[model samples]
Target: MYHIRASILFCGITFVFNFVRADYLTIKEERSYADPPTGDWVTNGVITPLDQEMRNFYIRNADGVIEVLLNEDVQIGLQTRVQRGGFEERKVEFTIGGKRFSYDLPKNLYVKRMFKDAEAVRKWEERGRRPIMDGKLYLKPIADHLPTPEQPWISGKFIRENGRFIDVQIGREIFQIGTQGHDGQHRFMGLLGQKDIKPFIQQAFVHGKLRGDVFHASELCLRMLEDSKAQDDPKLGRYLFIGDSISGNYDKALRTALKGKLNIYHPPTNCGPVRKGVENIAVVRRMTNRGLVGM
Candidate 1:
């Protein structure tokens, strides 16, 4: 196991990454809360329904549209009250997939329940991915330089510190920063709002240049183990790859590249999505000796 300490400047912010080697490190998806409504007239909520009350509904965001299965009929529970000037304020509360969410409908907004397609629902559930925003934030990676095992990849981390926003792109994936609600927490939505991506790029990029720090996965694992000063163990330096089918391919490639170099671990079953990652984080943390790193 080895350690590499590196620093870089991004968006006028300095970020330091500590890399270490271990038998295993966890790689999971990134998850964040949907952005809050921008005005008083708009509100947000989660949908969670009872097990027996299954239904299908469509959710549209700027990036794309997806149909979600609601465990209950949501329209039947819609509540409306008269506002000033003969306007109506509509609201609904429902549960889906064990999570409760709610949304306030605009005066003229229309929502329809789609006919259930078991196969479609199954496939959607299988994807295990969710939209990062209620509307479009236009967050897309530049295709100029593709990430590879040789060069690896780096992503920007938007952090809120002392009531100010500091944006920095580190070599490691965004998920390595840890979960939300911790000190030095990082979020993509907190720094940029929905709708336009132009302004975000303009502010985050200095003179249209993006700076990134680089570290090979093996080197990172060594650094992590060394930093923890974990005692030598045959099973100590392993890397666990967990994600959906897309991520599965990545795992295979990584395993091939790192063959005979490090111990790579992955489950027979591919992990579903960010939600699944959130659910199984504790188990992954427990399995890894030095701790998990997100991708």
Candidate 2:
């Protein structure tokens, strides 16, 4: 009787353990790669044999890899891998059938998101999240045309024109981009309308210097644009702002700042009549009109 009872208890415990495991799925890497190539991938979302409700799948491939099987051949975001301490998780995004999904993927997995669309890849690099894929850094261009915001200004990363490398500080859903240089100058840029300009400008000058950068400086004020342009590296070819007078005024400043290496291609091939939608400039003008100065 004792032997039989003990055997039954052991079997029961084994069954319970197996049952719990079956409820969850784990996909771990059996191998690792430093730089997994970039491209489009379709995954079989069902990892376990009994996967019925198919909700999430674990991706464990290597340092720079994420194993993802698609649910219905839908497009997905790029996933990249970064050396654990070298890169931080970015809230990269993707969409399937109009439903958006975001993952805090590493740099390596991030590069994978650019597959299928070279343009997408270019934009990702400009965001400055450093995938460094293909053993060399590459910058992809953003879509030629995007709908202008009704408020007449592009917002945040959307204004960069390149979607990949522009890095920004995020606060309460707000994206801030810029940094200070050794010369006591603050450099930054973004897509915001009139309302946001004062707060941003004030923040930069509160410390007693107009060391910040604005993304939507209208070309109408060429002097302002030129002075601001002399603060960055243009040869990097990572990001370039191309527009009309707004962009033109900054042309020489941009060249001087970058040592005459970077060039701005005026009259954006995609968005001509650049002055038509100068919402950012309008905001600047409004700020000036209100007698708010220095930022």
Where in model 2 is the C-alpha error above 4 Å?
1-271, 289-295
Candidate 2: tens digits of C-alpha lDDT, residues 87-158: 244333433223444434222211111232445445544675342222111123222221122221112221
lDDT of each: 0.26, 0.23
lDDT agreement of model 1 with the native: 0.26
**Top candidate (lDDT):** 1
Lowest lDDT block of 10, candidate 2: 214-223
Tens-place lDDT digits, model 1, residues 83-139? 232213333334322344444433332111111234433443356521111111012
lDDT of 1 at 274: 41
Cα distance off (Å), candidate 1, residue 136: 49
Candidate 1's error at 224, in angstroms? Answer: 30
Residue 206, candidate 1: Cα error in Å is 56
How many backbone clashes are present in model 2? 35
